[model samples]
Target: MDELFKGIADPLRREVLELLRKAPLNINQINDHFGHISRQAVSKHLQLLEDTGWIRIYQAGRERYGYLSKSAFYAFKDWVDAYLQWGAHSIDNDHGVFLDDTAYKKGMPLTQPVMLQALLSKDKTFDGVFYTAVKTTGIFCKPSCSANPRPDNVIFYDNKDDALKNGYRACKRCKP
Candidate 1:
């Protein structure tokens, strides 16, 4: 709840999130929509939204387009639903507050390379979920490796550090 509230508390980010919720838009488009703020300012707000898991970005050719990310909202919804239901049987809630831990308990999210290696080693295939570092381009792919294969000239990263070391960026889709 703190995270969600803190994220939307910013006026610029709130506006950006509102715009992105409608449709994906390039940085220039977002900047144009709010004429008062410079493009870099808009990008900074978008970056904060992204860091807080409120929005996402996708690369189209050379431009990065932004969109709202609703996963955090979904997590908040789940937490509130469970809390209300459980409190119905527990102590009355007039002066009580509870910390929601379900989302954090889901365990460390596996990296793309680790998941990919596991799938390949087991001879299994999945279609979604992948990771990339800012270093690589034209190689945003899935953990299952079901996408069209890239040349061997493309180095494979076994973990986030390896990818980041080479400057590859994470894919906005699948929430990598």
Candidate 2:
């Protein structure tokens, strides 16, 4: 658990995890995502993530693939869920809802255009990061929501409250 926390502590490692969320990639592919960071640094981060069991690396012929252990995040999610329930009745301020600072610093860029593309592609990588609200239907949805809405009628919000505040209701399908 300590190593898991330590591995996820770095912004670069989190970014790597996000990339892996989409699909497994080789070291070279992962390195391509971070042009500013050297390959050596990326390798070290990948090693740490593997040690923590957040990712699994396998070799197929000469190329090595690093796959995100999707189940590994469930433990962390359960821990957070417990805390959220514990504080459910006591807390204000949107129940601790907030954007990840590391994501912003690392250029996750939840811009409208970027989000629209993710929505069109049904990108699961951005599922919990933002909600998309449709202007025409007045409903908000998760990024991976199957319901298709025109890009012109969509707006992205950082939290559910923001979507609600903007006159959008939660989408029944995605339950955003």
> Which candidate comes out best when scored by lDDT?
2
Cα lDDT tens digits for candidate 2, 1-176: 67779889999999999999999999899999999988999999999999998999999999999998866798788878766774343243242333332323334566655666567757566777889888899899998788988778888898898998888899899886
> Which 10 consecutive positions of candidate 2 have the poorest summed lDDT?
95-104
Each prediction's total of clashing residue pairs, residues at least 3 apart in sequence or on different chains, is 8, 0
Model 1, position 105, has a per-residue lDDT of 23
TM-score of every candidate:
0.44, 0.51
Q: What Cα-based lDDT does every candidate model obtain?
A: 0.58, 0.80
RMSD of each: 21.3, 16.7
Task: Itemize residue pairs with steric clashes in candidate 2.
Answer: none
Clashes, model 2: 0
